[model samples]
Target chain A: MPVQLFGPVQVSDTVEIPERSGTAFTLEQGDTLIVIDPRGEQVADLLAFNAEDVAEIISSGRTFDYAETIYLTTGHELYSNRSRPMLGIIEDTVGRHDFLLTPCSYDTFHHFYPKLQPHRGCFGNLAAALEPYGIAPDMVPTAFNCFMNVPVDGATGKLRVLPPISKAGDHIAFRAHMDLIIGLTACSAPDSNGGTFKPIHYRIERG
Target chain B: MPVQLFGPVQVSDTVEIPERSGTAFTLEQGDTLIVIDPRGEQVADLLAFNAEDVAEIISSGRTFDYAETIYLTTGHELYSNRSRPMLGIIEDTVGRHDFLLTPCSYDTFHHFYPKLQPHRGCFGNLAAALEPYGIAPDMVPTAFNCFMNVPVDGATGKLRVLPPISKAGDHIAFRAHMDLIIGLTACSAPDSNGGTFKPIHYRIERG
Candidate 1:
């Protein structure tokens, strides 16, 4: 479960995401989503959703149009909500950035990290981000995970969290289509797979 | 219940706090004890652990020096667990921003908001911002409300939430002395009186 990089992105861009974007690689306008894998040794858990097309985000081997060559830079728009762009790409370090595949919150953390009881995560962030925009928690959609190494049996496509290749501070940015809102939770579960936590940093900027 | 705007602050620009700072504002270095009244019209719903020392942040406010002021154009490091700073002002939007508030949760909204259903808000995004920093729910410290316009009883000097003046997109930002972890729930508190919430942008930058 891995994905290659190719894009038009910049640093300090805004990002917006649909409530139901599956854990996959996707984009929108006026939104900045950064997967800062400290030292480029982690994976970013990403997701995407479109109005007509459910969630079409590519989890591993994300297509960045190698032919396009230009990474998402200031003003690149991500689309959603029925093909409307959700966020814009305003910054990037080119292919050097890795979309590590990481998602937070599972029952395992409850079993292992009991001291850290009631650990909440991103699934809830979406609800909070959407409130101002009129999006309610009932509208929260399933997400497409990006940078995640969800290995399917090759015969069966299944989601799985693998070791990351993203480093610290390596992030992504984008904008919103119709004021997309999202939530954030710094991974407290050391390893989400059964319950482990790896320190990560999520930063944002308005380019 | 309100303060006027002053001049642009730079790295080490000292400011003085009148008695208003004594009852309204606060500052800390070792722990994450902060709040904000985004409405800018309500008094900050602040509850302090070291409540007895309300006058200290005021004294510190007297000659509150702006040690550094970099336009968070891009890649501006505000504050983090690494190389912590004691006091940092939010040099956002010409150095005028709100960094003292909490996202009231749905429960709070229901309890405070009259007849209104729970709504979406900033709390989720605030939580998301903490994940990468390795701070978790357990790390969240008791927060103090800030920037709100609270009414002091004529003789008792008690604080109460009043109507707000904050416009859409008006925000508050701050730099933490310690690695701070925050949770958000866009305060739709029926009882929490403040201005209406319009969409706004939240950012973190490094100098």
Candidate 2:
């Protein structure tokens, strides 16, 4: 059963991603992808791959090196492994996001939540959603975690996952610089999503 | 021709990795691998994989999430994709190392050093060395950068690659928690090595 705690699903341009699940879709160059955290505190793990070549996937290292900042928001361009801009953030209602960690997986569950029932996490969801496009599990890289709060300790370089500050209906919008295959998930990790799961929403607007 | 600026190749247990190159070798469980910086300001990229199942590779995210700190040093354990401990740092001469950035590559050269002749960086070197072990390029993840100095800004979370503080003969030692295949490199990126490149040395000791 889909848990839709926010509101009645609007039938317009929005597409709802049920709690703890993921989906994949295509976005042509110049299109804008607006991802919404409909119920606040939910995290969306996002990934992008070149439509023409899967090898040219979004790269956190390249983006961080070039952008010079890990706190990516409006105006920040996401770079690919080939160092080409793939997506540019055009709008962000919630300014904080995380790119330092990889998508959580079954392994993550076993390691972090041994007492809870293990679930194949965002990694598994992305792999399954991307497999049809010729992407294998090993090919997946670190994701742009929307609405995820990971704070780094200045003195020790330590990191902590905290609840997101976004409110209901807060969304981030990205413009595709090139044709891309996007994998998006409503993150399954309890800590990442503030110990509760909720649906995510997104819409594509032609440029 | 290999540049030997450090000293006469001590033919004891040390294996010399010529400048800008990499090598892959096997280590049994409980074995210790000591990586040495024979020259000052040189960076070495190190990766590990479970010999029994190559799919279970070293995971920076898992390690960081579990260890809680990015400044990994002596007594820190490197975790695998499966959430199991793969390597434990038993000794560290230099306290600072980078696990935040991915291995630099040809794509890196094209992006950052477009003015100079583009050389495939550590990523390519690791790919070539690990290919024999059935590890593909995409299979590679962020490496434990030995002696590579990357400082993240506390205020903005920006990252900068700086010259290593490690002087000659500085080394870090890791004990294998499982039988493993290791890919190690003397990094080729100019900025990573402080505008120059040098050989890296390592030795294996049975537990």
Candidate 3:
């Protein structure tokens, strides 16, 4: 597919390689890219490399690495053990994004909180987005949360699901590994953690 | 009225007063109450006085002392002054809340954000909620955004509309001043802001 712009951006902003939420697609050489979480409360998982260099991101190319961290935030540098800044968080409005915590999914919910029944209710965000890709529900790992909140308890020193830090129009932009493939899943769990789910607009463009 | 508990607290939590969202009522003396923004992405305005200690809360019943300041982040303390913790930013999912944006109503569409007319819309959130109680459309003021994002420009130091900082179920709770009376409204607008409006639930209880 033509490298397209996905999320919303300013009127004059250039178009960049675009990808849907929770769906990963590779970028081409010489491709400029951006991902705007138009709604400040949204989050995104991004990775990049030279495409020719395996040392850049990874060979397996999983969408998310882990949740010990989540959304890209200022000070968090995207790099390899090589200690090079692949992409440093450029902008953040909601403070430190939830980099740790899995994206919300139905199968996971059935196993974790709100343990729902078989095939009923609103399909969790990631699961629904992955349906077209045929990604098995069983393969769902702990994807890092982008805008999702996961707080650390002072007394327990354990992580807990906190509220999202971004809102309807906040965004994070960065350079890319050989054209990076982007995947996202707009959350549908409208009533999960305290029923604060509010849908936001998405836009990806070239800066 | 008796006090009630709103959250999914311990199962044993009891209440003489029933707590529910989208209702209207007045506060009485000696009533310590909690007001929760179930959907963290809202700004609620509080107008209150000394239900009991008016002389103290209102600067010794000064000529004027309307509740002011923004609210957000769970565990934040809301004080009458810079000291006393009158209301704890208890149970906040989003970090900060706005205190100046007002709720939209059915009539609000016709008045503001009028480009997309011809479609169904409400005037204002609080106005609709207070219609049964004689609160009119013109009386609304800026609300405190619990999870909505409003950023002060780093360069100009001007307040600009940012994306939402909240998701579906994140919430923030505050204490009532007197027998508090409030009007509430949720989202319906699709063209305004980043358009992440979702349904939300509210709760009230006695502390």
Candidate 4:
């Protein structure tokens, strides 16, 4: 079992994103959002938008450009397309994540997993969950994939999706820089989750 | 003067995209779109969308994932969000290109070039040019930056944007797999164009 560190002082609520599903909620500034992979090797896709304006969505390019590294972990800030900070990684146990890939969609299923039943992947899940917040599908940008182990070959710049190294109970936490609308998911892509579907747990904590 | 090779057999009208501006046009299947940097070191941001459905836009993630390399060039196919091939590179004089970075925007200037006059940048330029086609700004995805030189550090995966090495008259040609709406720009970001801006020229041809 993985040990949880730097977690919330008081337990408010833990929301379970069932296997292959997603949810959306609001997190106020200074509050920490803890996303937990209850079972080992599960990947969670995360997105954030400014509460004041949905047009200001999280930008992977801005984050990668400012951070100066693709390996984003503690102390890194996620920036919006408008160049404003949205979230900061306050604490993290599993450091490996993916900001290079877009959320998988129904087309992803059709292209990669034709042998399996067609299903709306994480993109669709995020779109549906965020719909209530007036965020459209096209508005969804590249996601901050927590615990997704995608390795890019240095010499060739080739990418490979590998099983996540995050063990059971491992988690990553972020503190909001502004009032934000967040869409998160227990990823549905088989390749991303090491061929197993699992639940993701998260909670919002306030001081 | 750079030698143009494997160009269209017959002559066609060449459209000049003024410095710091953009334009949109439709290319039918099997037709080729050739984008040229009239005076080199200029970066032209390019975007493609399925003419049938605007929602099925070009996807850098899918293209990179399928091509297995971030350095996309000759013979590579650019894929859409739905995993369909949108265009294929038939010729490229300057092999270096960028698919990882989002189009530079007003916010990008605000963040990086605060002292410089605030320009809409390529993102805004593309949005404006594509608006008549019903493509909202939010629908724009990461652009395929032609002639842009962005090298990623092998050990750290850090990205650095350097001035394009393309010389005068350097160009790239892409054959459309499906009818596509193309948005091309003479990049507005100073850093991207090596502290100066120049015109981008393009012409569509049917064999």
How would you encode candidate 4's per-residue C-alpha lDDT over A1-207 as one tens digit per residue?
233466545345688999999999998888889999998899999999999889888988778767867778999999887668899998889888988887888887787899999888899999999999998886777799999988877667777888999999999999999999999999999999999999999988874
- Separate DockQ for every predicted complex: 0.01, 0.44, 0.01, 0.45
Say what the interface RMSD of candidate 3 is: 24.0
Listed per candidate, the RMSD to the true structure in angstroms reads 20.9, 6.1, 21.4, 4.3
**Residue B39 miss distance in model 4 (angstroms):** 3.0
Off by over 4 Å in 2: A1-12, B1-12
Candidate 3 segments exceeding 4 Å error: A1-21, A28-72, A80-86, A113-142, A190-196, B1-207
Chain B TM-score by candidate, in order shown:
0.40, 0.93, 0.57, 0.95
lDDT values for all models: 0.32, 0.88, 0.39, 0.87
* Backbone clashes in model 2, listed as residue pairs: none
Candidates 1 and 2 compared: the better one by DockQ is 2
Residue B105, candidate 3: C-alpha displacement in angstroms:
59
Candidate 3's TM-score: 0.35
For model 2 the local lDDT of residue A61 reads: 69
Query: A55-92, model 1: which lDDT tens digit per residue?
Result: 22221111211111112234544333222344445554
Give me the candidate number with maximum lDDT: 2
Kindly report the interface RMSD of candidate 2, rounded to 1 decimal.
2.1
Cα deviation of B137, candidate 4, in Å: 3.2
